[model samples]
Target: MTSTTASRPVGAKPAQGSNLSLGSLLRRPEAGAFLGLLAVLIFFAAFGGLTFLKPAGMSSWLNVAANLGIIAIPVGLLMIAGELDISVGAMVPFGAMTVAVISGHYGMSIWLGIAVTMAFGVTVGLINGYMVIRTAVPSLIVTLGSLFAVQGIVLGLTVLITKSTSVALTVDGPAKVIFGDFLFGGQLQVMVIWWLVLTAAYVFFIHFSPKGNWIFAMGGDKVSARNAGIPTDRMTIVLFVLSSTSAAFVGMCQAILYNSAQVAGGQSFIFNSIISVVVGGVLLTGGFGSVVGIFFGTITFAIVNQGIYYTDFDRNWSALIIGVLLLLAVLMNNTFRKMALSATTKKKGA
Candidate 1:
């Protein structure tokens, strides 16, 4: 046999140019989002001054990101699986009220309250999943209907039980310590930990595991995915359950954090979470995005949304700026997608 040389390998292919090259790096799924995040950070640092960079200032957006990210990540995954769940808006309050009504109003065991709250999440999630799988109705329409249905159920039940729209609780023991308490010099909420853990879990599930390929294939084309032996129906249902349960978890965390729940407060979560997911680089059409991209996208949004508070800009113009920035971000994501695909095609041909 010929002696193997360190200088040359028989079967190894040459490097596809430098890994550190701009084209190479920008082709990464998270590149567009990373650049967007950087731009926002620099812009905010310029206008928001030193306080904006301080821990106190950081907390302002980090806290917001934690709450938004928890929802956005799952929504992004659902989108990647080619689905949507606007019902989460109603699920949030429904979950909180589940706990609030059972434990707070009825003075039941807090443990029971928590269990029942999550149980309802499981129930609604199953319902949402089953309807989506069995029916050809677009997920948007299905969830939209569920949104109103859940909202009505919540309102009617809360009114019937507590006789008011607002319900309150005083969380104590481990529930407060684990779910609601602040940490790290009393600035960061414990929810941040939950967000990080879940993000990693999703990243692994969607990126490192074979299941991720199934999700991507589902988004690429459910028909083809099923033909390839993937369980599209079951996957869709599982994703729906995850999305709904995530919203409920966030709702429960909020209830524990603030000791209150309301019928109307979670509506903003519907719009806000979608905004965060879109900004994070998850295409509205699905099958294209990353957990990291969504993570950075969330921070970008939080910075822009919360940075306005630290700047001298008029509050009224904030919405306009947000809309502009979001459009620009989507444009950037689309452009990068084209470039990445072109580059890959060229490489294959080469």
Candidate 2:
């Protein structure tokens, strides 16, 4: 029997009936992204050598992946919900500076600094959500405006209060041990554990709860979702807050881990997070994605970004290779996406 579907992208909702088969699995939204991730892994392993798979090498990319994934997952959730938050780039440094200036520079309690840092994330998230909801503008435009504005605010306030663009932080006791510390023989970061824990929480929320269904509905059609009592505005606002707060948390952790904060280093995150999300199989149009897909995509991107270090390719040509490989991965993902659509059409026609 033909399964009734909505205008929603494939995978926006759960599959209609229980019919387990290879075709069914392949048609799942995240399948294409997962295959692409596997392809990238094999390619890097072949040329990048076994050293790339070593503990140290694995840690390098895993660490980077965790950091990027933490922010990217929330960013992915926002996209799935039909919103964006570019201001996270700025929030990272802002959060770090908030903690550093408060606790480190002024010698206040580290716990207080951390609390304020997260609070700042929530406040910015609220502003972003409010502007988008109240003004009826595209989330991209709203967040873009926030991007520069927050960056400037952070820079201005940081320089004004500390008289410097960079700040130092010193932490000890439980705060140091928990938020940021070298673990697993200093090759791994505490953030990795945080990332895993957060990922689990997100997985539960996105896949195992009624809330996940609401999120998918929002992505499928916000207006319809709202009419169905999904509370689109509230969800959007909450998503924005989560994104900003997550970014801030990363920044705060980095500061505590490294004992320093720089106002200029977090801008790369804006693009990197989006790229990871897209690569992970989230549709730019929203309404179709999986957190597991995002996790794999983040790993694929990190491998591409860091796997080059282990290869014999000339250092000067690294960027070109990374770009080419990433494009190839995207192309592969598209092929599977097309296959999924084709399967859907066949099933409907049959």
Candidate 3:
């Protein structure tokens, strides 16, 4: 028995590498984004003068983050789960318009309008997910189609119902209290608090939960995950639905805050949110990212994208800075991807 045990096959010992705590973050995709954010802050503080660090500047940038972070969070999750939802731009308007039409034009209760808006968002999400999973179509294509289709539907229906593209909302009482209330300074938005809280909760969930593990696994390798008993299809669908639902909620919140909804309100978010997610360290190809990274990324993008205007630099330079940032993000993503793949090879060799 001892001789047989000696001859039995056993796995090789793990390789000894660098004792770098938490691994080489430089080898991590998010490292570049982290560095980039610090660099931006330093540059702005040095050149943007004292105002860049002031409460007014803080409010300006944080407000932008709050608005953009909502979509960025969901979009980041979808990317991590190995999918996309370009339709969120339209979904935002869809939810807002649904509420506007129901509450403003149809004389329905605010709660009913809110319910209808959420339900419509859910239905759209389900349809998008079902089609993607059942047909095995690329999420990019499916959501792109959904984006256009929803845009058309929202435009046509809004025109048909209200004979106008914009709807005025008269929100008061609790709605105003929830959306318009300020927590810190007259500049601080309630949405800013909401964004931070949601980011922390999502980070906790993604890092600690079994479901979050499944999400990452499915994104990393769907076939391997399914073989290992993960419900890849269901997870994919649920992710898409979650993305849509979040966008809808943001839209509803905007509607309440602004007390108006326009058919064209969310169009800019399609590109902006994607850019923010990419800048944060989430790979477009899927898997290997963090909600904290995205949170930081959104803040970075918001500051850089909006802060440029306050600088002596021409506003056109804003576009240039964003482009440069995006190029850098792409380069960092490739570098980290190569490292991750190499890690896999090293594991196998060991």
Best by TM-score: 1
Error of 1 at 62 (Å): 0.8
Off by over 4 Å in 2: 1-20, 316-318, 341-350
Q: Count the backbone clashes (under 3 Å) in each candidate.
A: 0, 0, 0
- Candidate 1 residues lying further than 4 Å off, grouped into runs, are 1-12, 18-20, 347-350
Model 3 local distance difference test score: 0.81
Q: Give TM-scores for every candidate, taking all chains together and pairing residue i with residue i.
A: 0.94, 0.91, 0.89
Alpha-carbon lDDT, every model: 0.85, 0.84, 0.81
Clashing pairs in 1: none
Segments in model 3 whose C-alpha atoms lie over 4 Å from true places: 1-23, 337-350
Candidate 2's residue-wise lDDT over 196-234, tens digit each?
Answer: 999899989998888987888898898899999998888
lDDT of 2 at 305: 82
Better of 1 and 3 by lDDT: 1
* Candidate 3 colliding pairs: none
In candidate 2, where is summed lDDT lowest over 10 consecutive residues?
A: 1-10
